[model samples]
Target: MHESFRLRVVETKMSKMSKEMIHLLGNYGHIGFTFVAAIFIGMGGGIYLDQKVFDGRTAPWFTFIGLAFGIAAGFKSLFDIIKHQNKEFEDKD
Candidate 1:
């Protein structure tokens, strides 16, 4: 009886922890999507400009610049999210 009770307690704790992890994963997914969207938008804009303004140059300078901008934007967004989460934790404490 005691062993079964202990097993039940452990299972309950595990389930609760798993739920929390799932919640955290959902938050991460949102952040990841934001980062990817920013990158794609930047790249798309660059490609459009390169084709229209640059006359489809082989160099792809605009594309490179756009990629850099996109990465920067993504990092900035990630940092902002982390900072906000940290603040929330601090507030909770």
Candidate 2:
């Protein structure tokens, strides 16, 4: 009877852990997409400027600037998401 009770306790803990893992993954998926989209948009804008305004002479310069902007935007977005999540958890508590 004691061994059976211990086994049940372990099973319960495992199920709870699995649920938490799934929830974490779902949050990560949203953040991942946001980061990718921000980067692409920034880079695309830079490429367009370089091609139309710079006449392709400064092709790579604009592209590099766009990439930097994209990286910064992505990190800012990630931080915002994390801050929001933290606030949510705090409210729940």
Candidate 3:
């Protein structure tokens, strides 16, 4: 019984530590993921337009513009997410 009780205490401590680490890491990770995803989406959409828009008429131009727009849109979405998070924090405060 004593051994089991001691094990439980150790497990509880480890769980708390892990939870704190996750909280610390999660915020930074989310930001990094957002930036990477934005660039990827920009490049992907650009390539898609290069392939699908037309054949040599203006495909390359479309691809470049589409990619630029996609990146902008991605950043905008990230900004919105940050704003929402801030609002939540403010509400809590």
Error of 1 at 79 (Å): 0.6
TM-score of 1: 0.66
Model 2 lDDT, residue 51, Cα: 95
lDDT of 1 at 52: 82
Is candidate 1 or 3 superior in TM-score?
1
lDDT of 3 by residue, 1-93 (tens): 999999999999998989657855665457767877887888777776677656456667866886687778778877877787688679879
Model 2 spans with C-alpha error above 4 angstroms: 1-26
Which lDDT tens digits does candidate 2 get at residues 1-93? 999999999999998989778767877769989999999988998998899988899989998899889989999999998987798789889
Ranking by lDDT: 2, 1, 3
Best by TM-score: 2
lDDT of 1 by residue, 1-93 (tens): 999999999999998979768867866768979999989988887888899877898448888888889889999999988987788679879
lDDT by candidate, in order shown: 0.85, 0.89, 0.75
User: Alpha-carbon error at 70 in model 1, in Å?
Assistant: 0.6
C-alpha TM-score for every candidate:
0.66, 0.68, 0.61
Superior by lDDT: candidate 2 or candidate 3: 2
lDDT value for candidate 3? 0.75
